[model samples]
Target: MMMKKGFLLKQILWISALIFMFGCGSEEQFEQTASGLEYKFHIKNDSARPVQLYDIVEVRMNYGTHDSVLFASGNQTIPFQIDPIYEGDLLEGIMLMHLGDSATFVIDTEDFFVKMMQSPQIPDYADGEDKLYFDLKVVNIITETPAVKARRLEATERKLAEEKTIADYVEENNITVAPTESGLYFIPITEGNGSKVKNGDAVKVHYTGSLLDGTVYYSSFDRGMPITFVAGSGEMLAGWEEAILMMKPGGKARWIVPSSLAYGSYEREGVKAYSPLIFDVELIEIVD
Candidate 1:
């Protein structure tokens, strides 16, 4: 009986070991082999241009066993965040990964991209359909964290501040405003046409927005028209709705927006946060 029990214990131990190995294998997307590197990648370049080496590239790259294919490659921009691109090989960004790292992806290229890049030069394979395969390796990588994160952050703040100064200059010379409790200021540009721009009314305006330093962030002028948004019902920002309420139809005015009225100081991926902004706005139409 003891011998039989011992044999059962051995079988159970082996099964547990196999499960552990399989779990570990399914962790990262790609793995390495004798032939080179191997993995599938997600394709996201929907534009009619080829993916550039100067851009950050990320894929589900793996270089190991069969079970390692667990997660689909999440977004990984190559050239690592610290090392800004400066006109060299775009592939240099991901070249810093280790031997076992892998990326899986699907490549999407546009017709013009194929013509411009003559992409046939790279090592890739087609899988019987529209899909192409990419198996890459880090022959090497630029393993330095170029900027201490804090300093880089400060530099970005300084740039935004500079942009704001320009917007401030525009505001200083043009309009008059008074601050209110809602963190938005009011200026009586024109008299009303009876309806107060309360919640639910659709409002349209032509606007050009910039930092105080004068870098334009958004503009309805791009479309050569005004944009429409619902008011107090909340399709617009708090500051915008408040400012519009002060103006009547046909009113043209400039608004100096505080950070609390804009996207606040939260740093967006590529844009600085907490930026004081200015907008030259014309209330062209208000729809019910």
Candidate 2:
């Protein structure tokens, strides 16, 4: 009986050692950081600078569990600005990485779901597991500055001409369409087909923009080139985005953009503050 007990103990220890050495092979390389995070460096660039606070970062990211993928930024080259949700979370892990570094950070499923995601409970699909692996490759990090955030030059005197000028133009042009709930007037000249425009869609458009006083500021027609901007990406003015969202491919519309929807209270290039804008816009293509 003593010899049998000794043999069992030896077998248990041997198996434990084998699992520790070879179970996942790379398990030894992972280092614990924070309370519930673990990370391993597959590629590290010692010369590159680490990410800083409020810096906009472009990352090729795919976060998932052992068996399933939850979300992926597929072929989207758009950058994500990092703001830490907690003291020791995924954003902090990202801050630890340098440019061109490839690493994998393991996050707790409970922390991800309950804490960060604000879900009621861990989902049934991740029932037995408590870790979500984020395979990240730090692409580019842009330092945050006021110039990049708000490009305001100087506060200009308010003219308050937007409302009256837009009203006058609409009356003169025989435009008769009720304004939308957000105080935007979109008059369609041609109908389009397919899905309604939403965020993350690359849309190509041809536009001619002018002040209500008939001063043309910018036009794609004169340049002989169409401009493309992502929908809901803040690449264009609010009035432009709102009107384009109501359009589809091969559609054309006239948008009367008040200063509130255009550049409000700040003088911009070739346009005065509080000025109403008129745009003849055509949606040339919608790249999915």
Candidate 3:
């Protein structure tokens, strides 16, 4: 009887160990889609509606390899129409999610690398064997209509006109400053010492921004604090971003930004719609 009791206790312990292992493994399991993409939802709102074709959806996405973050949208949400049917494992996973859903998708890096190689330059982090991951949240969905399309087209046309105005101004004034590849025009007043600013470096800048007619809109000097942000992070205007990357610490420059690169068609408190902007900027330091 004593031997039989000991044997039963051993059997129970073995079964418990098996159950524990299976539970731990299951925690990491993700649902695989027909396209072979694997995904798991971290947050789901079943009551929220799923986006349909022709709907404009806003999403925040972070895409990278398992070990590193290559790119992120930060606090900004990108809006896109769902009509074109984008081809990718990430898009496929996104289609499965409803509004307010947050999910992580795992895609085969081999396929991604193949598509990326079609570009002129392959990124340094591209690895064929590594799995790419996308963490995305569907923020909102708007049904597109004819009015929305018309308004967008109108905005585009206005923006083009504003760009032409800036070009004409540059020509008439004989501004000898040339534009960068990204279309930012800058005149370096004083060359700063030290290393040139690069992407991903946190930098401090003192700037005074105004309209083309020399109407001052904002000045960092008035605030008594220099503005600091990660370079090339889209936290500032596109023209400012391009100019800052070209400067070193203590460099002073004047940037003439077209409407498209400045504020587009959006009018802020002191900025008018379709207005070209000028900024007198001084790079204070490269924090990192």
Candidate 3 steric clashes: 0
| Candidates, ranked, TM-score | 3, 2, 1
lDDT of each: 0.43, 0.66, 0.65
Among residues 3 or more apart in sequence or in different chains, the pairs in candidate 3 whose N, CA or C atoms overlap within 3 Å are none
Writing each residue's lDDT as its tens digit, candidate 2 over 11-53 gives 1111010011112436567887755467877679989988887
Winner by lDDT between candidate 3 and candidate 1: 3
**Model 1 residue 262 distance off true place after TM-score fit, in angstroms:** 0.6
Give the per-residue lDDT digits (tens) of candidate 3, residues 101-121.
Answer: 887777666554333211112
- Report the Cα lDDT for candidate 1: 0.43
Scored by lDDT, model 2 comes in at 0.66
lDDT for 85 (candidate 3): 21
Reference-based TM-score of each model? 0.42, 0.45, 0.50
lDDT per residue (tens digit) for residues 218-260 in model 1: 7788868677766654234446756777776777777776655
